[model samples]
Target: MKRSDLSHTIRETLKRLPPPYDSHYGVVPPAPPEEGVSVAGAAKALDAAQAAFGKVDAIAAQMKDPYIVSRVLTRREAVSSSSIEGTQSTLDELLSVEETGDDGARDVSGKLRPSGGVVPWHQRIDFAARPTVGDTLKS
Candidate 1:
């Protein structure tokens, strides 16, 4: 906005700045309306959210086998962390690996494929890690 408009706004807000920038100012956003949302609608949404949370809590609390939970969490962590580290695999692919004991398979092109059937995102080859000529040679 124009400096003059900013100065006028600042004066209306009773705020002051130092030096030549005394005329410069930032606009303060107006507070939200107290009655913006209907109370009944908000209450219904909250109830639904609470019900979903309670269901999850109940399932977690009722875990009959600790090993099952541990195994699930471990696989989740592995898949998630490996994706972050670029040695990526999906949870389903990881589970498939555990079941089949296969590290990798070749696609029709004979190139290394991430997983079978549809191409999962994480399984796509990361070509950026490939070493350039400079990487292979001395200075």
Candidate 2:
């Protein structure tokens, strides 16, 4: 529809959606591979991806400290999200907080301080005491 043909007001146009549109939108499924994408090319890309994953899997399996990978990834994700939330936090600060066990010592501690802050379940449980693993009620 051209702008010249639109005689209705902005409010009128918006109030009623045309065909294939409604107040609620449905989820769109993932698109199929493009028509031009050759089966050979797709197979080659899949092979490369599988090879890379195999190398990573082998390295991860051989690591003495597997949890370090998790910590590193968590810190990296926290650092990236800090900017979006208008917080100035560093990877070193996050690592230090976790190591020192300061108040609000979490991945996002720099963002959410301990003053009426949301606490993670990990912090609630006293791991040192080991009082019935599931019982977080123990003070």
Candidate 3:
């Protein structure tokens, strides 16, 4: 069967099936019907379902036409040199990484060692107190 037909069948089957059930404190509650199952609800459900089904149908229809599919899938030549650059800039902003200058750049040494350089005595003591995995060798 066609993919769209199969999808519609599956959707219909899901609609006919009983809703899920829930349990609380040894009590089981009957499953609520799928959203918009009533006449009023069905209208809303039908609209949404039709919209989604329409999209799938359109895609399936396109797939049946090899020329249309080829046109849809064919890579087009770059329209503008800055298209990729613009896309990257938008991505950088979305990622919260500053794309301007070296503002966000990090220095490895600064990360490994902080300013004023000396390790605190308490930290050193803690390090000495830590038992290395190799300490089991002695046991």
Candidate 4:
């Protein structure tokens, strides 16, 4: 069958599945393919499928009883917030190090020093010493 037909069929099948009694009950339908069944069309179909799955998940979530939902929501919120805070802290550390140039450099003792160099290590290759594979292998 056509890609659209297959996508629609999958969506219908998912919707037919029973939703959990305690959670949001909604299904985000997949978007129809804009073009024919090419790579791009396949990508679109995947996106649609993901959206539809998200909807179903939300619906199922809503179907849950209120107390359980509240507890779960609270836990999720806490975890999310904690995760965000952790990410923010990490980002802040990265940015601060970038700003101050303290991203773990090497000291005279071979210890990792704070980052504070003009250029990144990867970009600072020794162009002068660079030899082609043929040159290095030549007798």
The candidate that wins on TM-score is 2
Worst 10 residues of 2 by lDDT: 115-124
Off by over 4 Å in 2: 1-16, 19-52, 104-139
- Scored against the true structure, residue 132 in model 2 reaches a CA lDDT of 67
Each model's number of backbone clashes?
0, 0, 0, 21
Q: What residue runs in model 1 are displaced by over 4 Å at the alpha carbon? A: 1-25, 34-37, 65-139
Candidate 4 weakest ten by summed lDDT: 117-126
- Residue pairs with colliding backbones in model 2 are none
Model 4: per-residue Cα lDDT over 27-90, one tens digit each = 4567778874568878899999999878867876788543333433333343345344442222
lDDT of each: 0.59, 0.55, 0.39, 0.47
Q: What tens-digit string does per-residue lDDT give for candidate 2 at 1-139?
A: 4445544453234343446676532333445777865689889999999998788778778999555555565566666666665554677866676678675544454354442221122233323334464665653
In model 3, the clashing pairs are none
Which TM-score value belongs to model 4? 0.20
lDDT of 1 by residue, 5-35 (tens): 5555465664456778898564565667987
Clashes of 1: 0
Error of 2 at 43 (Å): 8.2
Q: Give residue 128's lDDT in candidate 2 (0 to 100).
A: 32
Q: What is the lDDT of candidate 1?
A: 0.59
Candidates' TM-scores?
A: 0.33, 0.41, 0.20, 0.20
Better of 2 and 3 by lDDT: 2
lDDT of 3: 0.39
How does candidate 3 fare on TM-score? Answer: 0.20
